[model samples]
Target chain A: MADHTATSGTNRKVCVEHLFKVFGADPADTIRRIREGAPKDRIYAETASVAAVADVSFSVAPGEIFVVMGLSGSGKSTLIRCLNRLIEPTEGRILIDGEDIVGLSADALRRLRLNKLSMVFQHFALFPHKSVGENVEYGLKVRGMAARERREKALRALEQVGLAAHADVPPANLSGGMQQRVGLARGLAVDPEIMLMDEPFSALDPLIRRDMQDELLKLQQQLRMTIIFITHDLHEALRLGDRIAIMKDGRFVQLGTPEEIVAHPADDYVAAFTRDVDRSRVFRAQSLCRDAHALSADEDAGVAAERCEALGREALFVVDAERRPLGIVRHRDLERDATATPGDALITDFPSTRGDAELVTLYGACATGLPIALLDDAGRLEGVVEPLEVFHWLGGTGAEGGGAASSGGEGEATPASAAPSETRRRDHG
Target chain B: MADRISDFYTLPLDDWIEVVVKEWLVPNFRPVFRAVQWPIDQVLGGLEEFLLWLPYPVFVVVVPLIAWRVAGGGVALFTLLSLLFIDLLGIWRETMVTLAMILTAVTFCVLVGVPLGILAARSDRFAGLIRPVLDIMQTIPPFVYLVPIVMLFGVGIVPGVIATIIFALPPVIRLTNLGIRQVQAELVEAGLAFGSTRRQLLFEIQIPLALRTIMAGLNQTLMLSLSMVVIAALIGAGGLGLTVFTGLGRLDIGRATLGGIGIVLLAIMLDRITQALGEGRHAQRPGLKESLTRWLKGLVQGSKAYNERR
Candidate 1:
């Protein structure tokens, strides 16, 4: 296995330039229409079929676990499958290291599968008949390893997933998490340079889902396989993806780092979609921190009171030892009538964000007023930030265009015209 | 027929001969197989000559080796014991003749039936055309195959071998098709992705994976051949089956018992060994039990809900 190279400057993992995948109803004609820039509606009317994925284009960087996220009917799953030619595209090019994959013959496709790619299906498609080991060994066997070697590889893959003992047994004997691990091992048995996962943990219970996520995190740390994961869950996307591509209809609305996407959503659709996220969980203190507040080396309650009145902010940053943010001092804490401190009151009444305390973590764990202080890696205070800044970064209150981002109010004709957004409409229906 | 009935194992001499002729002799000569008769006949003649020239112990070692590889140790041991029994029965040469006949029939099944099954699986037209014919081949008693076989092929090991193939070919075809069809879709995709040609996919992945199920069909075919060939004895298909049938013709119960005992031993040995081989590591691994248990539990609970819904 190659060492986990970051490939920081150049990415050659997977590239699709001018990729076109057309399915159903005279795909050739549809492609001709779509190519001539006939408006999407006119093309659809003529074809009586969708451009499930239109002339889309993107490239995933090497060693980066990029997520392609979309709600149902967005063709995200189809797009991923098209990468492996499980669902072949009708036109244009898909290149890996600048080689066109679209032109590959069946034998060539098989060779590609054997050598580089392994897929984790949404259903965790473990071969029901094989033991966990055999399931793991399947790709190895296909790639023509001897029995003993395949067995050893299978065991090693299983061990990586913390399922070494279960390798000798059937996957059916495992829990859902364990079964998913077996699927992961099966894909890993080939020692694939790239892994494609389609909503691999979507069906698991939440706790198991978290465990699977942790497992992926651990595996990615060790293996650093270039991964293109598809999912509809924003939480999942944020938690695992190094870079996220938000998709809608048949196009990508935005692609950026989780922080970038959260900080500046392309539109209201992304904003509303990311609304429920615990901001503190998604936001970093570094992004929100300002310079530490000034303070007297030694100030009594009387002097502190005068300083508080002078600054009419919602909260105050308390500094200590160094000129770094310490605990917080709320204006209200100075009033005895309120939760604020009264006459001769100090600012220590409220729970303060220690310099080292992560605002997002503290915000998630506790309900504290913002302008939360930033802290150094050690316990010393750095600066302070408003919780509202997190909301601002998420673009919950500010975003650009109206696409997948304007998830609210823009109830247009969805796939199922008659049904509201409660469910995806049966296009045929 | 009632008066002739002695036990589950025994039938009247005529009844027995009728079954062999009907089941083993006539059925093996399917139109497709017979269509290639010129080449098949030449090959068969050559093989017969070759085996005839070979010494008994050599045949003994060679035949047992085939049974051994197909199943392995237990079956191999049973094979040795069965050969010894036939030798002790004073029908060593005849039993060897029957063994040759069986080997020939099985080889025919593998050649014709496997391809037919694969074709049927790949194409609806083939399956549609063959289904009714296979159903008839299976339901008809072994005795029903005789008169036509006798008229067409003439009496001997060649004709008897023909009959045996007919009776045995259907299962191999059906199971081969079934096993191929039942292979998991993802694995098929995996094979395609990994560079298996359609032919390679079929032979390397599909066929190997399907072996356990196909072996079941093979076991059935073998057992059917062993039973049917005894009646092929009347047509001069010299084997243990014929010895038993001839013994019964003269009301020689002791001779019949020995012949019957030899068939039983051979059948048991074949069944145990093939069954063992068919017990794929996939099947023997502990996971299926858990899955089976889980499914059964789910099934029982589902039934309870079904009852409630009713």
Candidate 2:
């Protein structure tokens, strides 16, 4: 499990090891019982304590968007708060930039918060009495920065979020989305190295939420700051996360990139979440394409037909010297003119798509009955996409069935398709 | 059965309190009570002297101007009319004395109450400890504590002011604590997230947000102190209370009725002004300096236009 994390030790931005947060009178005793393999419910019944975060560990690479995705009461909120020591861990070590913060003195932890860490809250946590600019500059003011410099930094941060004009207005005067921008500006004003966002857009309207998400991505691209985003919305997790950790009952059930998780869920709990995912949008043509066998464009028609028959393919791709696809040569066309060269029998009006095109965009091209050629940036053929591959993926059983099946068999449906469709029917019905 | 119930033993709580106050508290705590009276005496004496020395005409102008700046034209007119009527009632000196007493008591209440409130707000244990003390201070009748106050501090205006302070101190403290505690939890967390110290959180976040509530508390304290004046006059505190006290004793119904009217007028003016302050409408209204400059500018411009026309 540790190997799944992209970075290790000193190179990582934030590393949490064996974190535990038990809400009760005797956390240490409860932890001991937990380590002894007592059931969570029994322990709770006996001790009346909630183990909010239980022995969770992960490392985040620098400039990575590591998302913790979970439902309410799944402890994602507790886990994010533990990162900044907002809620102190009952027992664990949290290393920020190779220094363990769990045992730091109060002053030291405060300095760490001022210098390195900032958080954006879900409810926009803006001070109602302060103007937006004042709210943005609060962190800088706490650090005792000079007035002029703090104002400049605050305005610059507000400008980054497109809210410089509203800085003088009170937070109550702004809409929810604009208030959250002020919250973001407050986190950004200090130029912290790691930003912890706890469902920062959960209170916003869906349209505004998407805009904020896009804005965050844009800002992150320019700043390259490591971000740990917590959200209960799976779509939000898939959209913003570079890597995601799916949490259930105070523990991480699976952690992987969005594609990896959608392609291969770890358990039924994870598969249940992935089942509702829009695979056409989450997946790209590159993920579904297969290696294509090509014949030289200069080859004879009789020789191309013989090669196509040997390969048991209806048509073969013809490419030039640079591997750029020229056209498709069908076995029937080649056989019709056996004495002619394959170039004379080539069909240049073949369907193709970009390598990075989403599967939804390629569905029309796939229906042309000809295998759609996936082309790279240089117009060279990367691979070919069959119609069955697109349907299998959209059919909801492609991940479990493994990569695209090459043979055209009618009975290729596996029993793995049943549960996901059952879930889908129940959800829609 | 009725005879048995009637013969049941009693606790002798009243006799026990009388013994404690007479033997232990009053004799042993005279110096402590005197020390407490010293500051109130200085403030009350200075305020009374100052108000008496100021010409009545100065107050009739300056106070209405203040009212106009904080509230609006209607309140200012009401203040002007009320002050003129009080002046006409032939109890101006007594009204000034009562104003001095109310100011002294409220000043002490605010100074002592706000800090205690902040302390209570910060710690649950402190809040729990102070809650019942505040309840007893508020619920006990003013007359009940008057005897002990007289025994310890003696019969004077200063002791009367001290009694008023004790009677009126609870609301400010309770409300201050309540206001600070009522500051939203997320705002406190945000302050902490930004690395604010405990003191910064109190001053910058908690106090500013709680200002309106605290001001409401101040208003309550002022009204309560004004109510205590009549009771304080029973122990020889001179004020409109003394006017009513003497009038009632000598059966001069007209004098007592006039004094009562004077107290009501003062209460209405103070209530209106303080209530405006608490609502914070004054923040948007022009301040005294700004209004003066703007009025001066308008007058100069009007005269210049007249000269040009000539």
Candidate 3:
């Protein structure tokens, strides 16, 4: 892991190495013992210190949303604040864009904060007495921008968050979601290269939380700013993260992309979190797709029907040499039109989705009474997404490795439109 | 039990104070004392001359207008009637003199108090040190300190102002410290994260948020100043305090009653005005009728933007 992170160090917008933040007496001594391989509990027992972030190390790539996820008191928040020296690390090197910020003088640190990084607090720490416009302009004012320029920039930032009209209103008048928007705008106004967001949406209601997540994703796409988002919500981490680091007891248990995590959780702690994830939201079409079981468009209909029957498939996808889907040909159609080629019996009404399309987007397409076609970005047939597989995965009963066959019962019955209970019955049987 | 507590060898606090004053403070602190006294005299003299010099009607009109604008019409009407009552009692001159003395003491108190408060709020060590000093300043009886002031600086309006300042300075300092300390930690963190200097954070974030509380402190200080300024009359500081004192001395009930009434009116006016300033500009927005009238006036005058903004 260290080798992997060190190789990517050149591209890192922020890199933290051996970061330890122990909150109590003689934190340095505790950090030294931790480095010497003492267990955190043992160290705490010996020193009466709580190891908040214990010997953590990671590097965030520029423009990546690196989410640090954990339960409360898991030290995820402590780790992110350590990135900007907001919570000074007990012992470590925090390099931002090749410069070590750990020992930067107060003057240099202020310059780093002003130009290189900004933070959006979890509670939307807007100045209560300041107007929304003023709140957004705060960083610029600290940088000593002229009054008129700062105002224009502040107005533009507010407009970016769809709050231009609320510029003059007090922050107290805005809802929690709107207040977080102001927080986002305030960070954006500085146009910092990286933003440390400490669970910016954790304070909002569920619906608003999702809305802010979408807004953040949209903004990230446009700005491509490096963001270190802290959250305890696994679903939120999966939804917004490019790569997520799961923290437990102030140590990162696993670090991988959302798909990697869902497909293969690192441990039972991670597995428990993934169990309740809405698989439709987390898994993409690619994860659900099985091999297309396609026949050449020129193949004889009888041959295609025989292939489908042998494979226990109800239908076959007929594709050209380039693997562009021609259409689906049901086994019955192939059997009825034995003289015709598979292309002649092809039914073009089947739904096709891209490989990267989320299962939520594939739900309607998959419900068309025919097997859903999963295609690559070039429109080449990838595979078919079976409804039974989707239900099993979403219901958290499916194994991580797919293609586990159901035993006994429903031997010849088509399983595509089977209710979830029927699919479970087949599986248990 | 008392003898056991004292150990029959008690040190004399007053003798120590006397020795320290004569031996240490008199020779080393005389110039500092004179320097401080100069400003108090200048401000008191300037304000006294101005207040007494103003045409009575002009002063009365201006005060009522300020009251109307700041605290609204009810307080404005009260101010007008109260001033007129003082005038009828023929102590308006004396009332203005008392106002001057209170104003001078408050100015000095604010100048000294706010900085000490900010210092206390910033540093834990300073706060710890200043806490007991503030307690002593507050708890010591005014007459007890007046004796020391008379012995050191002699009796005059300046000494009286000094005495009043010592008594009234604690609240402004305490409240300012409290206000800044009570500012939300997250806001302070936000300021720091954005690269604000210690000075910038104090002025831009902490002070503005603490304004209302600081103003409450000022209000307390002003009221304290009024009461102490009255007591300072025993040291020969002339104002309404002298009238009340003279009235009491010769058993002149009517005179003392008039003087007491003037101080009450002056206290109410100052309290209402300063309280309004502390509450911020829009906090005392006029009633619906006045707002409607202002809106209509703006509409008739065709100041479209102004009316809409309100």
Candidate 4:
């Protein structure tokens, strides 16, 4: 168990290995078929069982936010519940703090849930008969906490979620968002090291959903608990995930940071997800940066002009000896200043952006038509970001426009849509 | 031809049952029945004598006060007028005896039924096993079993109370089972997830949520007990039921009418009070004793919270 690192280090807070949950009378044959790589439909046709969760494995680092993103029925919720042993796995090893919780005695599992882990449900499972305070105090009460201490702790937890005044109110009186806050407070009251949030905000309206997301981010920053959040919304996943694992038909299609997923989706399914994403918000200037070939201010302009023509580049950043961008030297200007130095051909006051600026903010910078000089923190030139290259990277729909459609006619649509973006990149590369 | 057709199919079901029950079941179970009867008689007799010992006006006043506390002013006034009318008819002793018998039967029903109901709720196999038995118990006419109970335990208030208990027990058990089962599954899961023991989860979460349903079951049990207690008077249980029985035997219309009025008034009053308590309306006013106990609980709670903060 110690030797088997799920996907990362042995120090991981949660590790799930080869988990399988088949929903039917005879799971053994179906599981065997699944293990041999038979797809869900074929296995269901043969064995009369739905493999709700297939052979899935991932580990969450201590204090890391791991989001499992998938559509409904994709087994994301089932997979997370498997971690806490809420849904008993038909086959797997779930190691929480290096202890295999799947094999724990009932008492030990209860203790783990009480002291080490907590969960938030999608529908906010607050006790209808209990007040918000009592709901929060539930874990403490189960642990045999003194009534007063539990009350104090519950109040403190409520205060953390900005619902202190509502401690005595029944959960039914609160709206959906507030009720979810109560659920969060209940989970928080226990002070568990890990929180299994199963689509905690999915039941709210869009406005409340966004508000709750911000509140969760704030809470996570202060608490730093390892969170395994499940959601079907790609936008929510991108917003909250430090690292996301995209699930499809009970298997992870890809796992990476949000930027990595948006910029380089692994397949057609992932690219289909990317098409709906607001690309400007997801990609930063660094993602679109190209290597900036700079001419030194002292370099001769006739040579600069020929170099630009040979390279088929439209412009160059005129930089000092220290490589700090002074200004752009357009190809036309360089040609006009035949014997003059590159500095004499320089067109100063070009629009520039910091490497960390989002592409959305850099659109106006790109409107100036000269290459946008991408600078690092100390104002040194990192790269030149041309508007056309930015458009190509943003407009093209990831791997779908490339390798995924390799099967003849399917490839036709891929290249046809990619044609315009590719032309733009070529014209401006 | 018709006579032959009717006679040809006669099965002697009555003779066979009579022989089996009277010759076999009664002889074997008689001692067990007698042993159980001793306690029921003692409890019923003691309660009846105590209620008889209370002066009529005092009894009327105390009962109405209890009614007022449980069901509010209007029901209490109704109870007062009803009891005064029963006293005016000079059948207060019989009314007291009837009340005692009904109380004892309902109490025994609750004590036996609730735990069995909980057991049924907790296990599918147990519930399945009990379902057919409860169905048979509920479906059998009460008078049919009263004869067998009298045969085993002999005719008296003891046998009467025993029969009343049997007739009343089914509803409480069925309702308790239904109530526990009706508790939201999510709440039970929450309780288990928070480390509550099986017992704690049952008492703290399931029971509290199912409280209203369980109370409704209790109210049904109480009403059934009252009905059965009156019917038990035929076996010499002696109460307002005996008064009505004796009055009807002599064809004395006025006496029977007065006894009938007493039963209706008692039934309505008891039903309303229990139902009110079940609905949690009785908690609207805390008596001095209850308030004192609550204050003490508050103190303990406060100190515990203070210590926890430290």
Measured by DockQ, the strongest candidate is 3
Pick the winner on DockQ between candidates 3 and 4: 3
Encode model 2's per-residue lDDT on A1-429: one tens digit a residue: 234233346578889888999999999998898788787789899999989998899988888889999999999999998888889999987888878888888899889989999999999999987789999999999999998999999999999999999988889999999999999999999998999999999999999999999899888877879899999998998877778899987889998877678888899999999889998876666666666778887777877888889877788889999999999988988787789888887789999987556677887887777888878768998777777778887777766574535322323322222211111111111
- Kindly report which residue pairs in candidate 4 clash with one another: A148-B305
How far is B270's C-alpha from truth in model 3 (Å)? 1.5
Candidates 2 and 3: which is better by lDDT? Answer: 2
Give the C-alpha interface root-mean-square deviation per candidate: 3.1, 1.6, 1.3, 2.1
Writing each residue's lDDT as its tens digit, candidate 4 over B238-293 gives: 89888888889999988888788888888998998889888854244335556888
Residue A393 lDDT (model 4):
56
Once model 4 is optimally superposed onto the true structure by TM-score, how far is the C-alpha of residue B3 displaced, in angstroms? Answer: 9.9
Across residues A198-309, which tens digit of lDDT does each residue of candidate 1 receive? 8889979999998888788777777878899999999999877777889876777788766567756789888777778765455454544454344543554444556667
TM-score per candidate = 0.63, 0.87, 0.86, 0.83
What lDDT score belongs to each candidate, Candidate 1 first? Answer: 0.70, 0.85, 0.85, 0.82
DockQ of each: 0.22, 0.54, 0.57, 0.45
Q: Rank the candidates by lDDT, best first.
A: 2, 3, 4, 1
Highest lDDT: give the candidate number.
2
Query: TM-score-based ranking, best first?
Result: 2, 3, 4, 1
Question: For candidate 2, lDDT tens digit of each residue in B1-310?
Answer: 6577447887798899889988999889878877888888999999999999999999999999888878678889999999999988788999999999999999999999999999999899999999999899989998987887887788989989999999999999998999999998878888888888889999999998888899999999999999898789999899999998899999999999988998898999999988888885536433555688899999999999999999
> In candidate 4 chain B, what residue range of length 10 has the lowest lDDT sum?
B280-289
B167: Cα error in model 1, Å: 3.7
- Ordered list by DockQ, greatest first: 3, 2, 4, 1
Candidate 2: lDDT of A359? Answer: 77
Lowest lDDT sum, 10 consecutive residues, model 2 chain B, at B280-289
Query: What is the lDDT for B137 in model 2?
Result: 90
